[model samples]
Target: MNRSSCAIVYNGNLGSEKFLIQVRWLERTAREHGLHVQVIGNQELIPGIVDGSPVIKGRYEGQEPDFFLFWDKDIRLARHLEKMGFPLYNRASCIELCDDKIRTYEQLLNEGLRLPKTLIAPLIYETCEGIDERPYETIVQELGFPMVVKEAFGSFGEQVHLVRGWEELLPLVHRLKHRPHLFQELVKSSYGRDIRLQVVGDKVVAAMMRKSEHDFRANVTAGGRMAPYEPSEREREVAVTCARLLGADFAGVDLLFGEDGEPYVCEVNSNAHFKNIHDCTGVDVAARMLEHIMSKER
Candidate 1:
């Protein structure tokens, strides 16, 4: 197989310092491996007119690249790229299934994996009206207190909230009544720490222990600190299984230890950030990922 040129799709409008660093790192790795890499934003690649209408005829005038490296922010454009027959690192089907928290939990559950007890409420008028009409006490009695409410699709620990009691939960639910959310049994025994494992193909390339001293969330983007840690055999097995089940060529599996001292999958990300993983493990994850792409070509 000929060496393929890689096009990285990221949100070019984003001015985050971390994003810049990651783009530079990816560019350096791709160049070092003797592969051509170009980074471009979605808007730039798909041009639009003054009224924010896409110039369909003029857009994407150039031929599509051999392979596409889709970063997180540009994930919504995966299906469009798929229609163009582009080879995305993590394919559109994989991204669609893995991006939805509710669907991801369902898939893991159907596979008979140990996961936190979860319940999902769809964004429907009937469900919303029923919850609003019912007594708050009745709702708490069924789901219990100290549960977690999360948006069906969210990342970077932005939409996850722990409700200690009825007072905290009722208002939140009422506010988010219009949006789809899932209730997960809180794993308090884990002590606000979780393991993040990066899986590329069938291998676990890097792992880290993320901990928060003051909060229940352990995402590094949520002010959590990352440290070197080896996952237990069971943890690795489950993480790898989740990644494979999601059909992700590359993924990040977030595992939280339950009160029963078992690792439960919290979520799976299709476009996982590798900066923390590389920093914590000193593993060239990006390079290894590119190597995986090359090997697949062969």
Candidate 2:
């Protein structure tokens, strides 16, 4: 029998154990499914344009894989691969939307998904002369103090900030004003806690409740602890819908709780790392994803 094949694309610069573990799990699972898997780094694939056509320079010793499991946020490379006729698990468009928090929210809101009240920061070009503090008062008046500020593009909750009062919000906004960002009304009820639901295809495969007593963010990379969680039907539906709406084949959807325990879309990760979820729930998300990929292959 001829086994199927795939290339798992990951970030070239990120050699951290957590990130590598995700790649390793996918490789292992792909082999178990009788797939010939080739691990690739995004940097290794050099993309270029020639004569109004997309071209790529890379090392693939064999014919193109059945699909590309893009685990990196390199949009250009992902797009190039798509143009080259290789199907990607989560398409380039999906990655682009998820990479920018503002875009993700806009798309989700368009579909009528529940989310925290948000205000987008105006764009500040590098050539712009000075900071505009005009929007500060209006933002504080709307979202009030103790709001959440997030860079449009970030991972592991590193670029997310919790600001209290006028003093703190001023400097942080000034610092991030040159970049894309958004301010959100803080979900006080879900402070220091949230649920992560891993969705593969149309189903919620694995879930975990994340808690952080020391920080306002519940991301595992931000020192949060994870516990196995069995989500309610409402939670499952919300997560699955978010993934489907985002055009993602697999996604990690974070849902923040409201005062009455309702779910609100925190953020959707098209290339979400699942090491913590695996360790917490032992669900083998990588295997499930590969199975989904193979099912789609048929």
Candidate 3:
């Protein structure tokens, strides 16, 4: 029995508590399954010189692996790995496309999936003209009183803001104007909860319901609690569709139950965290991911 070799590309030192936990689990699971695994940081492989020589020259020296698991935060390095003949899970384009909220929305819409009414604008800055032309009052009148303001490239619920009225929207718009934001209709009736369906190789490996008690965003990282939940037939279909549409080998589809009681995809995460889903569902997501890798190798 030949053991498969794997490498996980990530930036764990950047305080990704969730990612660290998942990677540790992946390492343990892989070892237990008779696989060799190595964890490499993205920052350690950036354009730099080691001992006054090009870093890339000997960076991967004597380190050839069978599969490359390019996790979150190392998305930018996927393309480089492609040239090395290593199979990257989710691929670079999928990670890049799914990371941008606006792009993900557009792709989902193109697939004829239901999502929130969204408006994306250029980054806001003090010197930018027409900043006030699109006032908060105008946005509220168009979208509604309660809305969501999200940074174009934010993750882990760090850059999501719920605007209840004009007063809140104005300050938030002004603050995030220079940083590329999107205004979306808030799914108020959903009660600050959403479904996360984890897909690996066209199969729904694990699913969970995340509900935030205090915040509108229901990300597990945003102080949300997770519970095991079986996805509806529609949810499973759309979750698989979203991953396929984005060409992701593995992904997490976030679907919110709307006021109309229908599931609307909010976003797709190419390198989604699996620890919470695993804990909530007892699915052994890391082991499933390793199994997928091994099968692909075969």
Candidate 4:
């Protein structure tokens, strides 16, 4: 008999309390399944030499694991492992797609998935004095006031904002001028509320409804409360299809409600934290993900 083993890769800088909690849960769960789990940071795989080079001098010096339970957004390192012939759950491309909201929306739109009408903000160079507000003025004329402003690279609902008008929108534009972001038509029906369906492979393993009475964003980290949710067939299909199109082994799919109760893809997290969902619904996502990875490797 052979033992199955794998690695869990994470980012070193953003290893906060929640991140550590997720790591511990994964480590403990993997142990129960008779697997060797090595929790390593992205730095361990990429060395710091005088000139940038792909030299492995850290945890995985000369050998690669059978597979990886990748939970980080370090796409380069994830791709490096894939090049070494190690199968990664969710894969690098999936992570890359989910890491950027603009890119994710572009792909989702290309796939004909129903989603909020989003417009990518124009790129303003670093040397520019300030963004030309005329373009946004015209865009706002269409999207109207109270649009959703999202930084392409953000998480836990930190960079999401509800821009009411030019007063609020201009400040955000100046602040995030050099960064990649998008302006989305606000889903008033889904404001302060949404549904999260955790999909592992092709099946939705767990789900919960998140709502905030005081805030526009409903992320649990944003002080929103979660309740066990049973999505309708259409909702389930939308969530599952988004995950499949993104090529995710597992994903936390956030679906927003339209005026008529129609479901639209809000976001897809390739490596979404599952502890909150587990706490809310008592469905262990880590264990399921482990099983998914092992089954795929086999």
Best by TM-score: 2
Over 50-158, each residue of candidate 4 has an lDDT whose tens digit, in order, gives 3444445765786566778888998888887776677888799999999999888877876657888888888888999866778987789889988999999999999
Error of 1 at 184 (Å): 1.0
Model 4 regions lying over 4 Å from their true place: 1-3, 47-55
Weakest lDDT window of 10 consecutive positions for candidate 2: 54-63
Order the candidates by TM-score, highest first — what do you get? 2, 4, 1, 3
lDDT of 4 at 248: 95
Provide TM-scores for the models.
0.88, 0.96, 0.88, 0.94
Candidate 3 lDDT over residue span 1-298, tens digit each: 1347877777746775655887788788878877777887776555434575433434655467887778754554677667556688868889888988888887777676888888876555567655764455566677996788888898888988887887787767767767877889887777579999999889898999999899888887888999999887888989999999898888888999967667888888888888788789988877787788778878
Model 2: per-residue Cα lDDT over 39-112, one tens digit each:
88888888877798777765753347889999989998899889988899899999999999999998897665
Shift of residue 54 alpha carbon in model 1, Å: 14
Best by lDDT: 2
Give residue 182's error in model 2 in angstroms: 0.5
RMSD of 1: 3.9
TM-score of decoy 1: 0.88
* Minimal lDDT window, size 10, model 1: 52-61
Q: Which structure is stronger by TM-score: 3 or 4?
A: 4
TM-score quality measure for candidate 3: 0.88
lDDT against the true structure, each candidate: 0.79, 0.90, 0.79, 0.86
